[model samples]
Target: MRSHLLNDLTAEHYRRSVTEGVERVAARLATTERPFTGVTVDALAPRVERIDLDRPLHDTTAALDELEEIYLRDAVYFHHPRYLAHLNCPVVIPAVLGEAVLSAVNSSLDTWDQSAGGTLIERRLIDWTTARIGLGPAADGVFTSGGTQSNLQALLLAREESKPGRAAWEEGASLASLRILASEVSHFSVKKSAKLLGLGQDAVIPVPVDQDKRMRTVALAHELERCRQDGLTPMAVVATAGTTDFGSIDPLPEIAELCARYGVWLHVDAAYGCGLLASVRHRDRLAGIERADSVTVDYHKSFFQPVSSSAVLVRDAATLRHATYHAEYLNPRRMVEERIPNQVDKSLQTTRRFDALKLWLTLRTMGADGIGELFDEVCDLAREGWRLLAADPRFDVVVEPALSTLVFRYIPAAVTGPDRIDRANLYARKALFASGDAVVAGTKVGGRHFLKFTLLNPETTAADIAAVLDLIAGHAEQYLGESLDRAS
Candidate 1:
């Protein structure tokens, strides 16, 4: 039974297995022709379902071969030039190395006893990120699974802080008449967080945005005043640093000043634009992030690090105590009193991964300025793409992007109706994805479907975007022609 155990269970066996797997992945990535294989679930499901999990393959080599066929063969390649889908970035090499090292070590970052060096390294990275945001000396943070978790934790802190007399953590205590004010286009997580915190979805007041898709400051002020009139406590105002669809950054300076005037917690959801902290050229775009009570940063999005590398930084470190818990066996009160840097004191998760290592290695190998330059490259590419799209008569593009995303829709000469145009754009997106020619994203604006190009890859160029645009136009034309033929 001992001999039949997993290869990764032992140090020597783990090294051999991991090296082989990494080599195979590297080779596959280099040779893969398409960004996605366009393998349907129906086709792959039977093949995977046929494999009996009860029977174990004794040989690691044989298992690896089977795994490649079952998974790697159809995996979407983010590094591909035409992968203009979501906010996924082509990860840096140093971050990949860090992922490999951290997974092998399997260090749990909850307590100092479990991860001494890992704890310190994560703390140092937090400090560095805090300073980058110009958060004052008392700023502190904790690494989270991703932006969703970071946002959730930030709201949780706000909820705890908003309570009046007895702390929310205290026995027999209840919540207040708390309401979260956020842009109508802000991340869905704000509403989800509200629900999770027992505030219900209706507690989130959706403030209208301007024509540019940015939160209208006047509208926000109106909503805040309305909340007061309704006897609802405006607990927190979530200002989006970078919205998902339009990449439009809310008026953070104005939003921050409003929050200060009302004494409301300002939670900046900078998950998508936090990379600007390192951008020497575009850092000014995130002007009032320092004034935020808490800010969420997803390093994986723009910092070019792997997934699960994100943090929620607070302006006041004392606010972190809201999430603190003292476990007798894990992070005991004695250890915390002794000034031990137990990460569990701040994090919502008890057993957290050392995801900070990825960002640390990335920063160590490629300095902050280099990372910023990479982000700037993508932003530059987006501007070029925007110009190309706007100049073309075949498409209706939105306003100039604030970050590295462009929203547009194919508008053929014959398709004048709004419904027809929406169908054409949706059809084009699906057709292009199914053809495996190029992968792109779509979102609805004013109930009309629009294609989105979230350009996070610095390697993607104007030529690549131009080619993708051509493909999209071709698909849209094909769809329109088919629709006309059906009508005739």
Candidate 2:
């Protein structure tokens, strides 16, 4: 057990162990043929459950051999070209190197004492991002676990800032009257954050989106006026830069102006679209994001970084005081006067991992332009996919993609019934997943089932998309033919 610890004394042992693990992963990556193994849960669960955890394999190679069956053999490979289901991206090499270094050092980014240079590195990265967003000199932020935590912290700040100065109301009344306006297609985290903040169930009002799935600015203005007439406090307006299913961006300039006129806090949830910040060609897409009071960005989604890399930036640094607490044992009031920078002072989490290193190293090794080019490639690929879907007679595309996702459903020429079409599309997606030929995602649009392709992998070619479509058609036609035969 003592030999297992990573320190100066066991440097050789640590290096050898890590090298072996990396070799195993490299081999798996080279040999994996499909995105998934198509292994059923029922068959795989028993093997994992029967493993004797109490029996420790002393040798690293032996332990790895056991791991091959229960974990690696069944793991979903996101790097595969056919993995067009989710927002997961294949990570860059420099970021993976950063992950290796940060994990071994084990720096907790709570205070200066825990993480010395790590603190400065994270702060510098935050400053670089805020500058990219044009958040001004006073802008500040902290790294969070993901977009959800970032949104929660931003809303918490909004809740405190919306308090009435002329009159002191009961705590329950204040919480009840607060409202958050977001597009109906916005991420579910807005509602979850409201619940966590002890707000009423109806605190989040669903603003309708246009056919493009973007929040209608006219409807948003109407909602703001309604809130005023009804004597409710409009705490914040969450403008989504890229919706999950449709990749639709809300009208940012209009929404920001509305927030200014209404004096409401504007929060732009740009988690999926933040990669555009690095994209020279597409940076103009996020035009009015600079006017937002706070913004949430997830580098993991588009920056080709690993998971758990995201930040919440604010235009005004002082607003972060809402999430702060003075603890003598950790971060005290004396440290503030001494100008000692403690990251925990503005974070919702303590003992935070040094996740910013991944992005830092990624930027240093592959400059912002390098990251941007990769993102642009995927966006261009998505446009090509949309064109293919639109021209095809067998599919019905909902809307042209604004970012990198396309939502469409297959329609059989003979299938006149809507319900039957829905069932066929559903069957096709699951069948594709089970066959391990390709992986796709499904969602409902206007009460009709539809399939989605989130093209985050630049390696996924147009031919792969065509092949997957053919596979889906084959599976769907098989099911529909069997159904008709049974009915006759």
Candidate 3:
């Protein structure tokens, strides 16, 4: 136990153990041919269940070897070009190096005493990001676990800001009266946040989106008017910079103008589209993001940082006080007088990890332009894929992609009923996942089943898209044939 402790005396031991682990991971990555092994849960679960946690493997190499059998062999590799399932991106080398360093140092970023230089580094990064978003001089934010927490914190601030105004307007304005207007297609986290904030079940009023999947400003205006007429507090207008399913960017300038007119706090959930902030070619797509009262950015999604790197920025730094709490043993009230920078003063979390170091190292090594270029490649690839899906007679593409996601479904040439088509598409997605040839996602658009291809890897090309389409067609045809045989 003494030898295992990570101190100066055990530095050599730590070095050897970590080196061996890195080598195993690198070797596995180098040789990985597919995104997945298509291993079923039943087959893999028992191996994990059989392991006794109390029985410790005394040697690092032995533990790693055992880990290879149950975990590494079947772990889905996002770096693989065929992994077109989700928003996960292949992490950059520099960010991975940062992860290694930060994990070893184990710095808690909640207080200046715990993190020292790390607190300043995170603040500088926050300043850099807020400047990029053009949030002005008073802009400030704290790092969060991910976009979910970021969105939650943003909504929390909006709730706090709205409560006083609403209470003054009416006798008893409670959480139930607060309404959050957002697109019907916005990320599910918006609704989840509403529930967690103790708002009413119907607190999230879903605004209609256009054919492009972007929110309709006219409909939003109607909703705002209705809320006022109903004596409801229009707490916030949650506009999505990039919707999850369609990657559609809502009309930000129009939405911002409406929020200003209505005096509603504008919160831009730019989790997926924040990459466009760094985009050389598409920065204008996020033109009115600067007008947002609050913004959520997920670096892990588009910045190519590892998981759990996100932040919530505000135009007014003072608003973050809604989340602040002073403790005698920790962030005491006197610390403010002493000018001690405690991240917990603005965060919903305490004892937070120094996740900012990863982004810092990544920016230092590759710069924001490098990240933007990589994201641009994926977006460009998505356009090419859209063209392929549009041209192909076997598929029906939903809409032209605004970012890096394409939603389309297979359509058999024969006169098949919509139900059969739905089943065919669903079956095809499952079959492809089971085969491990290529992994794709599935969603329902307008109550009809559709397949989704989220191209985050720059290595994924037009050829890969073409090949995956053929595989899907083959699988769909096989399913239809099998269904017909069963019916007969």
Candidates' C-alpha lDDT: 0.90, 0.93, 0.95
- Model 3: colliding residue pairs: none
In model 2, where do residues sit more than 4 Å from their true spots?
A: 164-173
Pairs that collide in candidate 2 are none
Clashes of each: 0, 0, 0
The TM-score that candidate 2 achieves is: 0.98
Per-residue lDDT tens digits for candidate 3, residues 1-488, read 89999999999999999999999999999999989999999999999999999999999999999999999999999999999999999999999999999999999999999999999999999999999999999999999999999999999899888964346336655667889999999999999999998888999999999999999999999999999999898899999988889999999999999999999999999999999988999899998999999999999999999988999999999999989999999999999999999999999999899999999999999999999999999999999999999999999999999999999999999998999999999999999999998999999998999999998899999999999999999999999999999999
RMSD of each: 1.8, 1.4, 1.4
TM-score between model 1 and native: 0.97
Clashing pairs in model 1?
A: none
Per-prediction TM-score: 0.97, 0.98, 0.98
